[model samples]
Each structure stands twice: as C-alpha cells, then as structure tokens.
Target: MDQQIIMKIDDLRMYFNTNGGVFGNKRKIVHAVDDVSLSIMEGETIGIVGESGCGKTTFGRAILRLYKPTGGSIEFMGQNITDMPERKLRQLRSKMVYVFQDPYESLDPRKTVGSTVGEPLIINHLVRNKKEYEKRIAELFEIVNLDPSMANRYPHEFSGGQRQRVAIARSLASDPKLIVFDEAVSALDVSLQARIVNLLADIKERLKITYIFISHDLSVVKHISDRIAVFYLGRVVELSEADELYKNPLHPYTKALLTAVPIPDPFLEDKRDVIFMDGEIPSPINPPKGCPFHPRCPFATDICRTDAPQLVDMGHQHLVACYASQEGRLPK
Candidate 1:
C-alpha cells in the first residue's frame, strides 16, 4: 500500500537545555533525539516504543515542530519542512496534529467541547458560515462515538476515555493527514485503552491517515503498528515488523522489554525469563559513548564497551544494533 512517503524525519536532534547548579547556573543539554532517521508511509502506522525518558515523546514532538529541532531535516510529502517559516508551518498545522498523553491537562477545561473541536476550523478559516462549523463539529463527535449533543459540555464532565475521544475529535476537525499519538491512551483505564487503540486503527482506514504512535506499552504497539522501532536511551536499537519483533527480538534491551510484558497465562509465566534490568538510566546530559544500552546489557563485551554496533539488517525488514548472540554459537 506504499504510494509515496508522507513523512520523513532525517537525523532529527532535539536537546533540552537544563540548568544543573546552585541558582540555576550550569546549563547542560539533555540529548533527547540523537540523529534519528525514519520514513513514514502515507497511511501506515509506525509505532515507536521505548522506556520513559528514552526520547519517544521528544521525537514525536520534534516531528510536528512542537520543539524546534537543533539539527536535521523533516520532510512532509517530500517538501523540506525543517526550517519552514512559522507562518508557513502554522498554515500547515492542520496537516499534522498531536494528541497529547494527559487528556485532562491537554484539553482546556474552560473551553466547551464544541469550541475546542471547532477551534481549528475557525483558525484555519475553513468554514463559510456558522451552520457549517456546527455541522462539522457534530460530525467529528459522531465519528469518535461521542454524543454530538454534548458539544456544550466541558471536558471535566466526561470520563478519561471520553476526554480522549473529545481530543481525537478535535484533532480530526481539520482532517489531518498525519497525527502524532504521544502516549494517547496511557492514562486511561485498561478497558478504555483498547477501545481507543482499536478506534485509532478503524479511523485510519476510514480517513486514510498516517500515525506515529509513541507508547511504552509494547502490547499496544504490537496491536497497531505496521513497523515497530525500539529505542534504547536516545538511539534505535531494533526495528522490524510487529510480529517479527515480538517473536525474535534481537537487541538485548528489546528482549528484556518483551520478557517483562506479562503474558496472560499462569502455566507459561514461570518458563520465561523476566530480565530484571539493573542500574538507573544514565544521565541524558552525558550518555555513554558506545551503545547507550551497553552498560545495563547482560551481553555486553569488550566490543560492546568500546565500539558501538550499527543498525545492521538481519534479513526480512528486521534490524538490530547488538553484536553478540544470545545462544553463543553464531558470529557477530
């Protein structure tokens, strides 16, 4: 189903300037997205999975220009958008929108649902008359399975699931081609998370939209992703199809992540090795030189300590950065 590249982020870098001293004197950088590169197809969902603080959210934000990138190029539909002027970027805002993690904090409590959803249309001046605006808002609400009549109500009146639905409706108001779901359902109840994930999938087909889904939940990524990229610290350690990644995770960090995902079976639970990783995540201000994951990896060796492994393809769309074999028989 690949027609053309919809979004391409090349060597994206975003570092936050953090003060680390008395009276906020010493300013250090937190290397969030470190020279990351990826291409997103027009309508495929690309899931980004990583531990918190590993830069998944930062990467997503960098893509949408929420955070101005320090370096690298972002191309949308083959147009270089890295340095697109703010006015131009603002004009193109409807094409790419971000659905934030905390629905409660993300949505303005003071604004009514109708006004919030219709804000985009008003800003873009997409409506000719008042009737058209109300009709569009009603349609968006209906699409997300929200009560169209509740447009007059505030966000606090709804549950977590419904709040997210309202946010989704707002994001869809402008008919965006790509939407960045930054832990979009993480704060919802377990039962509601599935509904949102499934709704995202269903709406993608219906609307012909592309998604860059950032989540720590591997299982949710497994559900919605066409391709999955596993991030360790600030670098991509493994990337592959959904099933291939889960079945044969090459990176030690990826393997550890998968092992930690609780399987819903009492019998098979004890059979698997839950890699309880030791040590806190190294400070992003001064990450290790070699592989960022090498310090905590059980398979770390001299080579891993000194020379970082590149992302080498192990065939069939699977790529990994680990040089050692788990079973100790194969060559690096």
Candidate 2:
C-alpha cells in the first residue's frame, strides 16, 4: 500500500457565531468543527464515524470547500485548497467527487437517469458528441450493474438501492481519484446497504480510489475502512485501524459507541460491557470546556472536565484523546 498523503487538514475549525460579540454577548458559538486535523492517505479508505451532529458531514464539506472553512488549511495532494479560487476549485472537483447521503433526495427527479449521469460528462466535456455521450452513460450503467435500458427512465422509476447505484455511477462519471462517501448507505434497507457496501468494496479494489467514508454505522465502516476516526461534537476522540478499533477501542467515547453495537451471539453479548450514556449530545453553541466526551464519560476525572486533551500517538498509528489513553490507565 502506498503511504503517500492525498489530503492533509491542519487545525481545521468551522465555527458559527450564533450571537453577536460583546453585547448579545458572543455568548455561544456553534463549533461545528474545532481545531481538528487529519491526513488521508492515497488509495486507502478513512472512515469517519460519529453520532448525528458530531460534525462528520461538516468535516467532509469543509475539506471539499463546500463551505469556506472558518480556520485552518486544507492541502490536496500538497496544493493548498482552503482558499483556492472558484475556477481552479471547479477543475479540481473532477478529481474529488462526493456521494450524497440520500439517493432519494440527491437525484434530480426531473432528469432521466441517462441525463443525470451524462450531466457530468457534458459539464466536463469528457465526451465528444451526443452519440458518444449516450454510449458513455450506457457504459456507466453497466459498470454499476444497472440495466442500460433503464437509462431513459426517471429517478422515480428506480428502487432505493438502484437509485443509490445510479448515484454511485454518477460519482464515477468523472473518474474521481478521491471520493467522499457522506452517509452513502444510511438511507437504504439492511440488504440494500450490504449490497452498496459490497459494491463500494469491489469498486475500490478495482479502481484504486481513495475514500473518506463518513457514517454513524460502525459495522459498515469496519467492513469498508482501512482506518477509522471517531468524532464527537466536532473533535476526533480516537483513530486506529478498523479491526483494532472494534476489538480494542481506547477512548471512553469509542468504547461507549462499540458497546452500542448489538452482538448476534447471546453468550458473547452477555460478556460484553454495556455502556449507556446519560445525556443527548450537548449543544454545539456551548460545548463543554474539556474533553467533549467528558460530559457523558463514566470514567471522566476532574481534569477531564476542565482541560482539553490533545490527540496523542499511542503507537502503530493509533491515536486517542482521553487521559486514560495517554496514561495507559484504560480498562481492559
């Protein structure tokens, strides 16, 4: 596997001032993403797993320049892209595509599948003429296991899973090198989700595409990711190899998340430590002072609530942000 870095984000922060400064009191701001940084390696899938409103989607959008980042720099293949001009960014969009969460909502209901998939080719001028364009759309349909005959039909004609396949085909239309999977399978049924996940796995193996797969579903992330980054309220609490994360989560928040996954074997389920967090995720406008997880962490200490923990290396590419992880005091 190549160790080259494809995307590098340094001290990334995306905040929103919900109230005016000083008078209305600069009281609280929504820290959508706060002082977060991570690197994405070429040809590897980096799974970002977190609960809803944890800023996983914001992080992805920030890197793609979908939102002008409040702070920090985003480097794409070594080119600084945090503040690139619109024209250059438009050109770069081809190399980095985004697959939206809801296939039902993402597709334009007005457009035919043929027209929807072909839109990229037309915009990028990848194909020469109308005939060649139609042929290319047909090819993409075959690539995603969709019947070519259905190309003429609108999005409403397709099943949820089939619509997602069309969505995948649309993303592949530009032959992207780095694709963002934003909750790509969350909207589908269980069987359909499995099919899409398997499809992505096969496509990655064949095309060597690097991905930033964001999801709350740890099972899917574990199945598809080479590495996993667990986020909480805009900050990453842990990052490690996929298998390692499931089998040996370091951060308290990570362990809590793992405990939430249902075990199939009744015997094994009985032996696993079950963690039930007490509160809903605190508001982004006024997140806790210390470790974001400290508010709900059963093992939190006085220091954990007063001072924030920095992401520290815990050997072999595993990193965590809890005091326990830093001091090697974590539970077995």
Candidate 3:
C-alpha cells in the first residue's frame, strides 16, 4: 500500500534578523532553520532530536507556518501553505495544532480547563450549540485520562502532568491531522514523562494522527517515533528508521549522541565506551564554512573543513551528511 504524504517541505529556511554591533547598527542573521527538506507521511510520527540551539523547535514551527519562513516551501496535505495569507491559514489551523512544552504558559489562568479545551471547537465551529460543546469538552478530557468533572477547575489547580494532559486534550479537541509536540515530556518527572509518552503513543494509535515529536532526549523519542532526524546547528546531519539509527548510527555526531544515552544494565553500561566529542556546538549566526558539526566532529577531514556534504542515502534509507561517512572513512 502506498502511504499518503501529509506534509512536503523543500529546502526550508527560516532566518531571524537581529542587531549585532554594540551600537545595534549591524544586521546579523540567525539561521535558525537552514535548508531543511523533509517529507512526512500520514499516520507516522517523525522525531526531531538535537542539542539546544539546533533548530529542532524552529523547524517544527516553520512546518506549521507559525513563523513566516524566510525561504523555501511547505506543502501541507497537498496544498502549498508556505506563503498562505493569515486569514486563509487560520482556516487550515484546524487540521494542524501545536502542543507547547510548558502547559502553564499555553493554558489560560482565568478560564476553566473546559473553556480552554473547547476554544478550538468554538473557533472551528465544530459544535452546533452549548450542549454539544460541553459534551465534546467532556470527551476531550476523558481522552487524555482526565475526569470530565475536572473541566471546571483552573490551570493552577492541576499538577504538571495533568496540566500537560489538559494541553494535549486541547490540541486534540480540533481533531487535527498533525500535531507538533515540542519537548512535551522534557519538563515532567521521569515517571510522569513515561506516562505521558505512553499516552501520546496510545493517542497516536487510536486516532491515527501524525506527530512531529521534537526533543533532545533520544531515549524518549525512540519509543514514539517511526523515524528520527538528527539536527545540528541549523541542518539535519542524519535521518533513518528508529531501530536502524539506534543499532547502526552512520554519522559521527549520531554515534556520539547514542553513546550519551545510558544503558539500563550497570554491567553493560560500565563496559561500553562512550564517545565524547570535543567543543560545544557552533553558533548558528556564523556557522562553520563546511559542516555545522565539523567543529566538534572527531572524524572531520580536510574536505569536511572546506566543503559541506549533502544528505545521501548509504543503504536501508539511512541518510547521513558527513564527508567521513560518504568517503567510507567512518570507523567500524
């Protein structure tokens, strides 16, 4: 069976212009998301993972048109929405939603949780009357494992996890085809994180909704993502199936990231050699001439320092953008 493409992004670039000089006279561009192209299929969750300032969140926001992209194109559900007017984009928003990391900030303090959840329904005119709105609000709460009666409570009344659940319920209230979860579980406690991750997986299965799960924690992403894309600075360094990425990481940076994730077994953890890359991530404002990751990559060569390598499929649909990998110089 051929899968339907939900979103198609080509050479997506998002740049932010800011004042640089001490006098605030010089214009400096922050390449938040640079030349990123990705295709998302319906009913599949694609994970975007990278360290802080790697443009993972920006990429997600760009795809949803939350930010007016400086360059490139974004096609959603077979329609080009990259330059769609705000008035028209508002109509399309019902099919796409964003779940922010901090529920406390996303939810209103004065309104009841029910009101917050049903805002989408009101905007989209999904309900005919107050009775339908109330009933749908209850159903949304129940879907996220929150009691329908709790809808009357305020955001301050709910715990962190519960508040996040409320936020999730609100996102689903619109019956969106795509949801962007930006560090949704990173702020929760370990146990809470596990429960929310499981809940997200369950929701995806039952609803058959596509997700863009953005996080720095590879372990959590592994559980929910069908495929993973590793970002560095403002570009994707590697992309592959979840299992293949964990088992055989082609890029040097990908290998380093996997090594950082601790194994559950103490004995095995002690025996494993962790690959520690030198130096911090480069500044996106003035990224390295060649690869964005070359500054910290241990396997960097002269070509890696002079020329950027584009993403290439080595095998099994694993795409990597490292000169070392392309030249077969990556150590086994």
Q: List the residue pairs that clash in candidate 1.
A: none
Give TM-scores for every candidate, taking all chains together and pairing residue i with residue i. 0.95, 0.96, 0.98
Q: How many backbone clashes does candidate 1 have?
A: 0
lDDT: the better of candidates 1 and 2? 2
Winning model by TM-score: 3
Clashing residue pairs in candidate 2, if any? none
Task: Put down candidate 2 lDDT per residue, 1-332, tens digits, no spaces.
Answer: 99999999999999977757765665567999999899999999999999999999999988999999999999997899999988889988888889999999999999998899999898888999989998999989988899999999999999989999999999999888899999999999899899899999999998899999999998999999999999999998898999888888889888889998888999999998877788999989889998888889888888899999998888878899999679877677
Top-down lDDT ranking: 3, 2, 1
Instruction: Give the number of the best model, judged by lDDT.
Output: 3
**Candidate 1 lDDT score at position 248:** 78
**Per-residue accuracy of model 3 over 1-332 as CA lDDT, tens digit each:** 12899999999999998877787678988999999989998999999999999999999899999999999999999899999999999999999999998887989999999999999999999999999999999999989999999999999999999999999999999999999999999989999999999999999889989999999999999999999999999899999999999999999999999999989999999987677899888888898998888888888888888988999999998999998998889886
C-alpha lDDT values of all predictions = 0.88, 0.91, 0.93
Q: Cα deviation of 5 in candidate 3 (Å)?
A: 0.6
